[model samples]
Target: MHYNLRHYRAEAERHSHADFHQIIISDVGKLELEVEGRAGEVCGRRMAFVEAGRSHAFRAEGLNRFLVLDVNIDLAHKTGIEALWQSRGRASAYLELQNGAQGSLLGLLDRRWFRSDASEFTGDGMPFTNAIGDPGLVDQIRLILGHSRQAVGTEKKTGSDIPTRLVRVMDWAETRLTEDIAISDMARIAAQSESTLFAAFQRYLGTSPMRWLTAKRLQMAWFLLQDCQIQLSIGDLANAVGFSDQSAFSRAFSRQFGRTPITVRRDARKLLGAKL
Candidate 1:
């Protein structure tokens, strides 16, 4: 179940189905609301959630800006959407924001609106901003929530592209080579089954993920050793990139590039010596 905002006008907002729930907040002007066979009412700076099969029409007399969060309750529940949801599609959810959080959420929704309209941004994969609230906005939200609940956990990856996701996972692993990069975590980012991802990597990049990961580690180690400021022993660079033993790193490096890490570093030093 996707949650997004759709804006429409009086004449544009014609008779429609009541199968979805709408959370609407008028930011400006006025709107005349009517539930089928009922007296119409004017809505201003008001928010309401109208449920499915409930006949309703909204007509704004003048230019107005508002947010309409349309959600499918059944689908949302089935998908385990952890985001905040108002009472079972009956109450108008007017989120009273503290410390400018409301404005940020509005901005985020507006950006999604832009992306939804523009071909350059629209796609099948979920938009990155939608899954993880805007980083700056999320941080503030966390600060506000912190006072109300238990401590929040560390930041989680909110990215969803395959290649970009792979790069992000690898970058994190590069920093924490001492720890294993969970296969499950990588699978989540790739948005594919483990077998599918393996096949896709071989098809696209012509290498297995783990092999690619090892290559990246060796590359990082090589760079670290070549840097003049780095004064660590060969073993230090190996361990920094997840290799607990220098011999193992050397063997892997030699297998891939036909040269040991020490020789590579020595060769780099020679090049530097000649340049000086």
Candidate 2:
């Protein structure tokens, strides 16, 4: 959890973090970033993700302050950082932050990351304003850019219409939230190979298929946790959502929703109390 305000000197600074992922958000002025031979920049409206083990260099002129987050490579796996690394190049250049939520997201990040309370790129494939220091802030960023499509390379689909086969797959997954389903299972439902299914998901959903499945399962668990009409023990709720281990379920839920199962249940009780 390395969140800091960084400054690069006028000279080019080249380095690589082979053990962790680093997110660079532009603050005062423009900063050039070259990661793994690919180049991008961060202005007031841009940012960059430097994945682990990639050779990266940075250069900036005049006054500049950047907010950078260093994430463990393991945590980067299912949490939208992987696709971002894959989608960086050529046509997907300049990942720009979204319009309205940019201010709020940056404000929240500044409060949490910096001592004060404040944040793109050419590639709209990834949400640029994202700062994942807190679970609640991460969930907020999730809601803001959750609908945008992404691509693995450059052919990202920006259309609103969901791919028909993907829709079928989503609907099918919704019904089997409690089951032990995998990416192969989803590919089978889509009537395609796992690679093709993975590509389609990356192109249309901005995430991998298995990550989406985990998200869906956690979403169902959230719904159950917040429902006042139904009372399920935490372990029961976890089991109902395909989590054999309650501790793992709680960790995933907190990561996704910024709250624990017990907390969510308590909130529901508070809601009921208010209603009564």
Candidate 3:
């Protein structure tokens, strides 16, 4: 039941945790959310529950802070948290907080819940075990999340420091991403043999260097499309991000962001209308 404060940039992201469920409540601006095939936005006291191990993605604009809690599945039933789920791990829920639910959740926002005191609610003294005995705080959780057909639901922090050598490669890739760069170029930049570079990338980033570069190129293209001022034509934009064929670039961009360049730019225009 440890809580965390997270900030998501406007850039789109897609990933998942295999061992824990995630509860996200927006504290500031809206967060575009797509979890396990359903899509919604979290804001205005709205919250979402993403069951353990489901693939999800999110994006946001302007300033935003989200209150995040990572829940262990085993603790769910034990803590009486599963009262909200409609169908266990396969289905997720999104709802607006009601009653004193918002207050109950926000009360736990004290920074101490995230640090050493995190253990204050586990084991025989388990938050759930204790919660069942006293029933005050856990009851509040059930009240808020148990709404029919609605609403929502930290942990072993994953990932390690990106190896220092790979950092050099990434920095070099960003500046020349528009240029025709290859794995050899990246390996040379890091002064590592191609095989070694491959190992490091697979071990750290879970992808090959060239694939990572292509993703980076597409991400850059996406950023450009979001900006109101960068008005390059689709073909020119494709070449600018190192894609030789405009059609191929469009397909890749669509695959990455689920929207064609034309569509993203059009949406950006609508959003930027007031600012411009």
Model 1, global lDDT:
0.48
Ordering by lDDT: 3, 2, 1
| Ten residues in sequence with the least summed lDDT for candidate 1 | 145-154
| Candidate 2 residue-wise lDDT, 46-98, digit = tens | 55666678788878888776666677676666565555445542334345544
lDDT of 3 by residue, 21-89 (tens): 667766555788888778888764467888778888888888776666666677666765765555432
Candidate 1 per-residue lDDT, tens place, 1-276, comes to 223333345572545445545545444444555555442332321234455677776666555545444445554344322133332212322222222122223333444234544322211123222322333333222222221211112222233545655544444333334445666655765677788767766866689878866776776565555654345578866765667788998999899789888888888889889989
Q: In candidate 3, how many Å is residue 237 off? A: 58
Least well predicted 10-residue stretch by lDDT in candidate 3: 122-131
Pairs with backbone N, CA or C atoms under 3 Å apart (clashes), candidate 3:
70-154, 94-151, 95-151
How many clashes does each candidate structure show, in the order listed? 3, 15, 3
Best by TM-score: 2
Summed over model 3, clashes come to 3
Runs of candidate 2 with Cα error greater than 4 angstroms are 84-94, 116-134, 140-276
Per-residue error for 69 in candidate 3, Å, reads 0.4
